[model samples]
Target chain A: MSRLGRVLLGSLIPIVVLVIYAFATRSGLDPYYPSMASISSRFSELWLFERVGSDVWPSMRNLAFGYLVAIAVGVPVGLLLGMVVWLHDLLAPLIDFARSVPAIIFIPPLILVLGIGDVSKVLIIALGAGFPLLITTIDGVRKTDRALLDVARAIRLSRRRTIWNIVLPGAAPSIMGGAQTGLQVGFFLLIASEMVGASSGIGYLMMRAQASFDSPTLWAGIVLLSLMGFVLNLLFLAVRNRIIHWHLAMRAVSGSR
Target chain B: MSRAMRKSILGVAGVVLSLVLWQYLTVGGPLAQTPGLPTASGTFERAVKQAGDPELWSALATTLVVTLAALLIASLLGIGVGLLMGYSKIFSTALDPLVQFLRPVPPVALLPVALLVMGPTSNLAILMAVVTAMWPALVQTLVGVRGVDNVTLDAARAMVLPPLLIQTRIVLLSALPHIATGIRIAASYALLMAIATGILTGAPGLGRSILFAQQAGDSALVFALAVYAGILGLAISQAFSRIEGRLTRDYGPTAEAAAS
Candidate 1:
C-alpha cells in the first residue's frame, strides 16, 4: 500500500475506537468516560475563554523561562567543566549525586525556601532541566575532534576564539541533543511544579477538574496539554534543523555510506 | 600524590566545601533569617533518626513497589507493540504518526485523567508511570527490530523454521541490546512517575513523606528524604547500566553510546 494509505489505515484505529466510545457514552452511560462531544465542546469553551490566559499562557511562560535559564546556565558551566579537567574531576561525584535526585523531590524544599511562588516553580524546572544539558554539553565539549583542536592551536587561535568558533560548532549536535532532552524534562517538571503549589497553569486547571469530578474539563485540559506538547516538540525540531543543518548533512553522508 | 588519589581528595573537598557553605547559609549566613531551614548537622542528625523510623521504610517500600510494577507493565506492552510494528511494514507506517504525536505528551499531564478514572490509588500511579515510561522502550524496540538483518531472516525461512520460532530466536536476540537501553530509560521514568504520583495524590511513598515533612515544618526530615530519593535514583540507574553492560558485551560500543 502507499504510505498515505497505510497512514490512513493506521489512523482508522483511533478514530473507530473514539467513535465507538462516543456512541457508548453518548447517553451518559458512563460518568467516567465523558463523550467525545462533551470533550470537544469543553475544548471549545476552554479555547474561547477560560484556559488561554489563566492556564496555557502561564504554563508556557514558566516553561520558556525555566528552559532558557537551564540552557543559559548549563552550557557555559558545562563548557568550563569539560575544558578544565581538574574541575570536572573535583565535581564529578557531586554532580552525579545531585543529578540522580528527581526534580520533584526538590519541590518541597524549594517551596519552603522560595515560598509557593513563580520563583520556586521556575527554579525547580531549571534544576530538573539543567543537569541533562550540562552532562551532554560537557561530553560534547570534551569530545571535540582532536584534529580540530590541533588545527585551532596551530593557527594560534586564542582560548576564547577556539571555544567560540571551533569547540562549540564541533559539539553543536550533542549539545542540541542535550537541549532537546532538557526541554522534555523541563516540560514535565513544569507540570509537576504547577500541580504542587501553584494557583494557575494547565496542571492546576487539570488538578482542579479532577478534584471537582469535572470529566469534560479534565478531558479538555488533557487534550490541550497534549496539543501544546506536540507543538512545542515540532517547534524545537524546526529550530534544531535550521541551526544544525551542517550536522544533519554530515549524518546523512555517514548514514548513506 | 597519585592522580587517582588526588582526584579523590579533590572530590571529597568539593563535597565538604558545599556542606560547609550549606551549613553557613542556614545557621549563620545572611540567609539564616529564614525560619525552619535546617543546618547541615541538624539535617544529618534528623536523617539518622529518620533512618530508624518504620514509616520512612514503609514509604520507601511502597514507592519501590509502585515503580517496579509500572516498569514491568511498560516493558511488556512496549516490547510487544514494538515487535509487532517491526515485523509489519504497513503497521509501522500507519502507526508512525500516532507514535510521534503521543510521544511528546508529558506523562505527568495524564495524572488528572488517571485520577479521575482510577481514583487516588496505586493503580493510578502505575497507569501514569506506564503511560510516560513506555515510549522510549517502544521506539527503541521498533528501531532495533527494523535494523535486524533481512539475510538472517531469509536463511531462517530457507530452513523452514516456524514463524514463531524465527521471531523468538532471531528477531528477539537482535533487538535485545536496544530493548535493554529502552528498559533502562523506562526504569528512570518509572521511578520519577512513582514519586510524582505520591507527591500529587498524597500516596503512601517517599514523595508523600517529603510533602508531609515540609508541611509540618520539618525541613531537616524533608532534606533527608530528598537525599534518600537521590540515592535511590542513583542505585536504580547504576543497577540497570550494569545489567545493560553485561547483556550487550558482544554488541560493540554502539549500545553504550546510545545509552548516554
Candidate 2:
C-alpha cells in the first residue's frame, strides 16, 4: 500500500505539471508553450513514421555507422595500448588532451573542411564516440587481476588464447560502459551537427521548427527525441547485460557484502 | 632515464611527431592544396595573435562566466535534490522515476526549446546546462549518502550530536569525496553546454567565435580558436581533477583504491 502510494505521489508532479500546462496554454496564453493537445496532435502527425524515411533513418544510419567505427577502432587500439606499456605511456598525454576536448567542438572544423555532408557527420560522430571506449578499455585492461594473468601463464596459454579467454572477458564490463557512453555522446554529436548544418534529420526538423516558431512541431520533436534517447539507453543496457551478465552478478553479490 | 622521465620524453616526442605530421600535411604534402586546411605554423601564428586580441579574451571571459554560473547552479540543485532523495525513502521513490525519465533525454534535445523560450541568451545555456550537468552531482551524492557506514553513524549518535549537527558533520563529510567527483563532472558538462549554447544559439562566447570564423571562411582562425577551446577544456578538467583528488585523499578512499 505504501509503495503504491509513493508511486502515486511520485506521479502527481508530472500529472499536475501537465494539467497546469494544458490549462495555461488552452488558448495560447503562453507564447512559448504550445497547448498539450496541439503538441500531441503534432507529435502523431509529423513523427509517427511519417518523417521516418527522410529524417529518422538518415540520423540513425549515421549514428550506427559512426558508433560501429568507434568500437572497431577503440577496442583493438585500447587493447594494444593496455598491453604495451611503453606505447600507453607515450600516448597518455595526447589521449588525455583529446579527452578534455568536448566531442562537439570538432563538428565545426570538420564541416568546414568536409562540407555539410554525411561523410563529415559520420566522421565527427566516430571521433566523438571513440574516446570513451578507448579510455574505458585501457582502464579495464589495467585493472585485470595479476593472479589471473599468472594462472594463464602457468597453464601455458597462448597469447591469443590468453586475451580471448581471459583479458577480453575481464574487460567486457568496462568496454560495455564505454560503449554506452560512446553511444550517448554519439547521439549528442548527431543532433548538434544536424542542428547546425544538416539538410535532413530530426535535429534539422527541430531547428527548422524553432526558427519558424512552430512550437507544436518543436514540442513534438522533443518528445520523439527523448523517447528515442530512452529507448537507445534501454537497448544498450540489454546489450551490456548480455556481454557482462557475470560481471553484473558479481557486482550484486559484492554490494550486499 | 627514470620511468617518469622516459614517459615525459616519449610524450613530448609524440606531440612533436604529430605537429610535424600536421605541418607537412597542409604545407608540403598531398593535402597542401585542400581548401580551409591551414598549415600548422599558420594556425599557430593565428593562435598567438588571438592571445593579444582583447575581443578574444572578452569572449573567453563570457564563456567562463556562463560555464561557472551553470556549474554553480547545477551543483547546488543536484546536491540539494539528491540529499532529499537520498535521505527519505518516500522522496526517493517519488523523484527517482522522474529523474530517470529526464536523465536519458539528451540535453541538447531541449536546447531548441530553451532557446525558443529564453531567446538565445546566457539564461538558456545555464538552464539547459543545469538539466545535463546536475546528474553526476545528484547520482554521486545519492550513492555517497546511501553508502555511509552504519558504524560511523552509530558513533556519531553515541556522541549525542543533534540531528542537524549529525547530518552536517558526519553525513556531508562522508559524502564530500563523491560530491567533489560530481562537481568535477559537472564542471566539464557546464563547459560543454556553455560552448554548445554559443555555437547553436549564437550567444556570445568562444563557440560563437568559432562559428563566426567558420562563416567568414577564416579556417585558420577557426582551427586556432578550436585549439584555444581545447586548452581551456583541458585546463579546467585538470584543475577539477586535482582538486577532487586532494579532497578524496583527505576525506576517504579514492575510487581506484576502493576498487583494489
lDDT of 2 at B173: 82
In CAPRI terms, model 2 is classed as medium
TM-score of the B chain in each candidate versus the native B chain = 0.86, 0.92
| Per-residue C-alpha lDDT of model 1 across residues A95-205, encoded as one tens digit per residue | 989988888888888888888788888899889889999999999999999999999999999999999998898778889988988988999988888888888887887
Worst 10 residues of 2 chain B by lDDT: B251-260
**Structure candidate 1, residue pairs in collision:** none
lDDT of 1 by residue, B50-167 (tens): 8999998998898889889999999999988998898887777767778988898888877887887777788888888899889988988987787776777789999999999998
Cα lDDT tens digits for candidate 2, A110-224:
8878999999999999998999999999999988889999999999999999999899999998899789879988999999999988899999989998999888888898899
Q: Give the runs in model 2 whose Cα sits over 4 Å from its true position.
A: A1-3, B150-166, B254-260
Q: By summed lDDT, which 10 consecutive residues of candidate 1 chain B come out lowest?
A: B250-259
CA shift of B209, model 1, Å = 1.3
Task: Let me know the TM-score candidate 1 reaches against the reference structure.
Answer: 0.92
Candidate 2 lDDT by residue in tens digits, B132-200: 899988988998888787777899899998999988877888888889999998998889888887888
